[model samples]
Target: MAPKHDLQYPKGAQNTLNRYSDRGSYDLEKVHKIVNSTPVLHVSFQPDPSDPFPAILPMIGQMGSFERPSSSISDPLDCYLHGYISSRVMNVSRAAIASGKPGLPVCIAASKVDGLVLSLTPNSHSYNYRSAVLFGYATPVTDTEEKEWAMEMITNSVVPQRYDNTRIPPIPAEMQSTQILRVTIDSASSKVRDWIPSDSAEDMANKEVVDKVWVGVVPVYETYGEPIPSPLNKVEKVPEYIEEFLKESNEEGLAYATAAGKRPLPVKAKTNHDE
Candidate 1:
């Protein structure tokens, strides 16, 4: 049988995984899943000498292949991040290109904690998590078509079918104020921890620690709150699409967390590519 085409990037060399190397993966599918599943991505970059320290911001983004629109998570793709047009990071990216540099170097980090592990010993306490770190160069997206597509893609990701349910295309002024950063990842690595606690032989031998203490995994998940309708809204009822979305999405989160990365998370409703 042919082997799966795992994500091929600089492994331990570029972003080394010191501990738990067994749980680390360079596979594109695994890494992309963690990145997309995470609603907020923390991006870090070096600041100019005028700044006091490194800059890190929680931003929203997704992985996509614009050229190959049908590309799957297992395929090579670029990370498109949404930001304000006048933001300092965006300005730095724009300046880098003018200086003959491809883009600004950045580090992208994301994670999802599935459960809290309670073990016999304090040292054994840990979180069941899926995490990833990507090393990349970011540039401000300039193409009109790609930028529009990315904006719509991001909107749909938040709440399925949300883009169409609202005003169609945004106005020119709205588009002008928004900016999208295209991050071309050079290499990335993902780490996952979802196993039951394994107590040391010394600790296991002690009946008080093993039997008396509550040692187990407490599942954690994200769920949507009740949808609030506008006071001036004209709709008679909550649309089935939204109700269905809430049901499916909320259940999917619980299911995925319980499964502990063993199953794929449910897909979000899509949007019109032309929108």
Candidate 2:
């Protein structure tokens, strides 16, 4: 039997990493995981051809296949973005579809800093981070079934099983007001830095400089605070799902960041700033 190999997004000029190329990956699994785990994504798109400035909006999005619902993260998936119906991005996407274009061109980015790398010099300082970028065409989801499914998936991405816990289905008014964009990705890539601080050999050999300068990684992770209830809430205690979600999410984040903080220095890591 042939060995199974991980699927990768083809590297192209649109989604290629130039500097620090060693840390970059085209693996679909790595890229999708970073995007799905990120709470907010920055989506950039041009409103019009004559517009001077491109618009970048922080949006909530999730990656999944509507046709193959059970597909894994490594499998190809479209990014589903939630936004207001009348938003500029949505309007542009709608217009593009109406004009018979494939969809509106967009770039989606997600990033998370796990640790702050304090090196010998300010120039050498960096962050232990994971970042992904995707170039895609954003088309408005017009089908009722697909839109609702995307909504449910996005809601669950925030808190596991959250969609079912709340309303079974969105009300007519809510459905009418919300808009979902299905992004067909052309290419994707991710870059990760998860090693201990790197410093030049000259700096490391200098006792005075090494003694004076503190060089290490400070782990950073997001923490979820206790849930505050609404004024009209009847329930005295928080739901178990909410409590468990917070605990598990916090633990997972801390573990990842802390592990990165303690990671051994890479053998081939660039010691000089220019390198």
Candidate 3:
């Protein structure tokens, strides 16, 4: 894989790192890849006046540079999120823009755990992880061309080559029922923690303590299970594309997790989100 070129997001009040700031990264490639890799994003937005508290939702979203369709996930791009046409979030974005207010402001967060860190001392335990947060202004997609492109981009993200494997284009009913939001990111930051456990010098020097406890990272990752076809289907065999994709994906996940378990941090630019 080609190395992702890093582009740093300008530091701002909203995105400045405070704790363990050395781990914080403003690199656009790292931030965007984390956001895209997370299976579910936690999106927080201001609630309606009727509610006293802010609201957040678990949503699936994809990053797409429609103008630069071939752009990698690490590239700076607009986040296209899918939701019901009448969903409160979508309605809020529209209402905000229509009222001459700046588009609805939101915070997007994603995270991944790579390993379980074990230490002789309980207080020193932690997990190896990568997490990111992005602040953005969102607007309801208005152009027909842009909307269609976003829809296809999101569909394929659910599974590799899924959009082309199952359907050619969506029907009118499907398109009308779904809504897309284009989020233009303003600032973002990511923090990564991947390293050997840091136990106290006393704990490290004690042979009794070291002998009694197990210490090492347990690699954690997602893997694809065997595919089960629909009962009504007449096909006797699975599609080659589907089989190949599943195999390759599993291999990639295993290889990465193994490497993570052996090293404190990866040296190459990551394209896949590993949580």
Candidate that would win on TM-score: 2
RMSD of 2: 1.3
Name the regions of candidate 3 deviating beyond 4 angstroms: 1-5, 265-275
Q: Could you tell me every candidate's TM-score relative to the true structure?
A: 0.90, 0.97, 0.89
Q: Which structure is stronger by TM-score: 1 or 3?
A: 1
Model 3 lowest lDDT segment of ten: 266-275
What order do candidates take by TM-score, descending?
A: 2, 1, 3
Q: Per-residue alpha-carbon lDDT of model 1 for 75-190, expressed as tens digits?
A: 99899999999998898889888899889999999999998877787877777789999999999999989998898878877877888888978899998999999999999999
List, residue by residue over 150-220, the lDDT tens digit for candidate 2. 99999999999899988678999999999999999999999999988888888889999998998899999
What 10-residue stretch in candidate 2 is worst by lDDT?
Answer: 266-275
> After aligning candidate 2 to the native by TM-score, how far in Å is the CA of 128 from where it should be?
0.9
Number of the candidate with higher lDDT, 1 or 2? 2
Candidate 3 on 80-100: residue-level lDDT in tens? 888999998999999999999
Error of 3 at 183 (Å): 0.6
- Candidate 1 yields a Cα-based lDDT of 0.82
